[model samples]
Target: MIDDELRARLESLGGLDAGPGSLAGVVVIDVTRVVAGPYCSMILADLGATVIKVEHPDDPDYTRTFPPMLERDGADAFSGFFAQYNRNKLGVTLNLRHPEGKVALERLVAQADVLVENFRPGTMDRLGLGHERLREVNPRLVYAALSGYGQSGPYRGRPAYDNSAQATGGLWSMNGPAGGPPTRVGTIIGDLAASLYGVIGVLAAVRHAERTGEGQLVDVSQQDSVLTLTENAVVSYTTEGIVPEPLGNQHPFVRPYELFACQDGFVFFGGYTDKFWKISCEIFGAPGEFDDNPDLQTMGARFDDAVYAERVKPMVERWFSGRTKAELEALAGDLVPLSGVKDIAEVVADPQIAARDMVVDAEYAGYGSLRTFGSPVKLDRTPPRARGIAPDTGEHTAAIFRDLLGYTPEEIEELRAAGTI
Candidate 1:
């Protein structure tokens, strides 16, 4: 049964917005760091979970030390990496080696709904905080483990980062310009994909826990996430016996899908369907040239680059180059899936980006105002909102200790004196 008060709180953004963000009242223990684990926790935090970051006393999240830090009075207060991923969360430090610290974390786990970690396969077990032990304490706690490889595999114990996952996964094998060297995707898709998968798995596990009071382990591999993205390439090689190669900017299964040169810049066209292709042909002043030809008329036939390049590329290129980007957009933007290639400057200044709140200003005391990307998912009832700037390291330690653990001031001081927190 839904608690009306809690429901009201979740449905109203705690008086901040139209609705309380989804996942309100959910408690998340974020023991993860860097991209995969931290980014996942970040998403959960964005959805209004109470994410408490658990950092090792000796060596906390290195993201805190990353470059491009926020300086206050000539001292680094926070890094851009930390600010980006650790917002809407509390920060705390604990030495798991200490019995008191370990006990405190176990208590936190017993009360938490989710726990996210991204260590090597056996690290948590060695630390006595493995999923099995934690589940024994709280059966309904969702435990998500993210790693470069899976929790059980030949490469499970090996350390890996974004670049390693990208190189090992099929993404690097299939990415890059056609017939060129293997090129890495510009973004850190390996880590980002792992975070997305982890989020999905966590949500599912949490739902399961709610129904059955039985938590489960969610194991996400960065390599597997990256490999999942090479679906088309893998299918081509395994099923059709065709070795895939990278084709620069051109669609593997569609004709006239690549960027074409215009007078001022480049324009992209994804008019892959029959009607779209016909429209494109008419726009290129080659109306009847491809309408009757099966090779150009059908999508699969157009996948053949030789036919497309010989029959269609020159004509489209000539037509595109004859017009400026603005002229081409005026002529065809609404007719087809088309856009002029935009540089970073143009993207930042794009009105569509602004209208969608993709770019917004976030103000911090030391940082003043920084432009950041807003949440992409928009819920009709509970829209996501940035709570505030990220807290300094262990900034909420005293409050969390006093409120959550019922620790008296003396106990808190003792723990701090003993280096247990």
Candidate 2:
């Protein structure tokens, strides 16, 4: 039960009221920690859904203290990564190993339209929050499971991270420069890709449930999601019996599709088509060489001739060496596809990102001015925005129990004293 003062504060802040003309009625119970699952829930919360993030009472989310963690009020403040992924969420803590905690969670689930979890395959079932158990309590609930592998796969029980998934899914095998060792991408591509796929599956399940009044499980595997990005490599191995190797920044099958050095940094150039290639050659003042070199005439020939890339690199470098990033961009105009490599600072300061509202400020009581990435999707009629900062652990526990579960103050106090929350 919420204290009278807290209840008054919540009421004044409009407790459980749907945002105007929004998809605000739906509730999302996020029983996930770390990047992938929390990121998915954040997206839903941005879309006006009420997302309640459940954290472990004892351990909490380790990411809360990840590097770039701020220090505030004597405790290690929330990491920027954690805050970014968990924005617009209400947070609560529960020791799910306790029977009372599980009972409270079931009560919460009964009111939720969706439940997302990213534990290893059998963890939820062992916790008695499996799909069958959940659906029995609320048949309309869409259960989305995000894991390293699909529920029934041979590797389902194996531990995985972004790098592990990238390697196992054949993504790392086809990355890096030609003749170099397989290199993993700098970003957590596998985890993020899986999260986005999980989002799609959850929404699809929601739509189906709305139509048929039945809910089902949506399973998203990081390896499977990353595999979608390795389309041609998989095809090459299967259809042509070719073992694809890393081509660095270059396309394995397309010539002149790699990054070229510029005056300051690098510029990626891809002229796959004959027309684009002609334009690129003309821009570089190498039309004669472009016309005469038989190896450079076709993508296939250029790919086959290792000497072709070596010959063209110097010319391309010279052309870019004389031009600033802006000048080169202006010269290329709309005809040539080129982009300057942007570091994190450049990306953060980019006008296009600001104009598109890809960053927003959320208030953290302990930490002022929490700036983080915003929702990318733009809905015409129901645009999404960051609602609030991530809550402190168990911040909304008593309030939610009182308002949604109708628990009494005496009961909540007993649970708290018993260390159930």
Candidate 3:
């Protein structure tokens, strides 16, 4: 039971007073860990799903140990990394390897709308709680499986991580500067992309189940998701037989549509279109030169490698070298698509981010009010939000077992003693 002070603290969180979210009545059983699966369930939780995140009693989610860790009187209190992706969810502990634990999971599945997991392809089946078995418990359940590779592929059983997915998905080969070594993306795009695809699949499957009363597996693979995100590379190679290489910050088809050095920092400019190019020329005080020089007249003419190297590139470099990012933004940000690159500190302080509700304050257990990213999705009436603080390990175990599973206090004690909770 929550004490009055703790209850009040939770009630004062960012989204608790927002009435109902988009998925108000949905229930999600999250058996995932780390980044990919938890991130997917977190989005569902943000959208008002009652998500119960289950981990083993002895082995909780690994991210719980990740930094930046909070401390209350020098003891480990909370993990900011975990909190970022796991807010707005209930937490429970159950050992699926135990027979009673498996039975408890089946009971939960009987009443759940969706179940998500990110294990090796057949790990759930090995535990005798695979989608096939759970469908017997609830025929309308949407079972989403996120893995390194899809369930049917040859590499499905192989263990993989974000770097592995990037390497295998063809994104690594095309990410770095021209003629440079293959570079992994700065962030975990492979896992993030898979998580989003998993969310999309779950929502669509839930809708199908609601309408047809039949549920199917939603299989999402990190490698496949990352491959799908390799914009134009696959098609360009397939159709034109042109091997794509990293162009650093340049767009392959659009000349001058890349980052340029400013006096202070870098700014990305998209003055590649015909209209924008002319406007850019006017802004650079070279409208007459642009009109008179046939080589820089059309986007096509400027796209030629020799013409760009000889004429257009040096001119843009000279003009941009004289201005700061702020000055360039002030001159051309609204006229053309341009933005001064911002670090995280600057991003959180940006007025547009504040107005759009892209930054929010979340109250952690020991750390009073810390910042976490807000949800990007915005619905007119029922928008998404970081609904609550991340739960401690098995924080709601007793309440969930008593209320949802109809377990007596005596049985709860027995399960706890058996280490099956």
* Model 3, residue 333: C-alpha shift (Å): 0.5
- Per-prediction TM-score to the true structure, in the order listed: 0.91, 0.91, 0.95
lDDT of 1 by residue, 1-421 (tens): 1243643433233222323568877789999888889889988878877778888777888888887766678656668767787776777888888989889899889768999999989998998989999999888889999999989879999999887888888788777898899888998899999999999999999999889988999999999999888868777888898766777887777777888889889989887788887787777665576656656777766667687778667767877888888788888888988799998888889888888887766677756775667788777787677544565677667767776667899999999999999
Q: What is the C-alpha lDDT of each candidate?
A: 0.80, 0.79, 0.86
Candidate 2 structure quality by residue, lDDT tens digits, 1-421: 2233433344233232244314456678999988879988888877777788898888887788776765588665678878888877777888888999889999988988899999999998898878999999999999999999878868999888888789988889888878889999779998899889988998888889889989899999999989999968877888999988887777766767778887887888776567776787788765586777656656665555465557656656777887777777778847888778888788888888899887787766666777788778888788886645777777788877877788899999988888888
lDDT of 3 at 17: 36
Q: Give the per-residue lDDT of model 3 (tens digit) for 1-421.
A: 1233433333233234334677866779999999999999999888877788999999999999998876677666788899888888888999999999999999989878899999999999999999999999999999999999989879999999999999999999988998888789999999999999999999999999999999899999999999998899989999999877887888778787888888988888788788888888888855496677756778888888888778787888887898998899899988988789888998999999999888898876556786888999988888886647788899888877877788999999999999999
**Model 3 worst lDDT window (10 residues):** 1-10
Query: Given candidate 2, what's the lDDT at residue 116?
Result: 95
Candidate 3 TM-score over all chains jointly: 0.95
Pick by lDDT: which candidate is best? 3
Q: How many clashing pairs per prediction, in order?
A: 5, 2, 0
Better model by TM-score, 1 or 3?
3
- Among residues 3 or more apart in sequence or in different chains, the pairs in candidate 1 whose N, CA or C atoms overlap within 3 Å are 11-20, 12-20, 13-19, 13-20, 178-248
**Per TM-score, what order, best first?**
3, 1, 2
Poorly placed runs, candidate 3 (over 4 Å): 1-18
Give me the overall lDDT of model 3: 0.86
- Report the backbone clash tally of model 2: 2
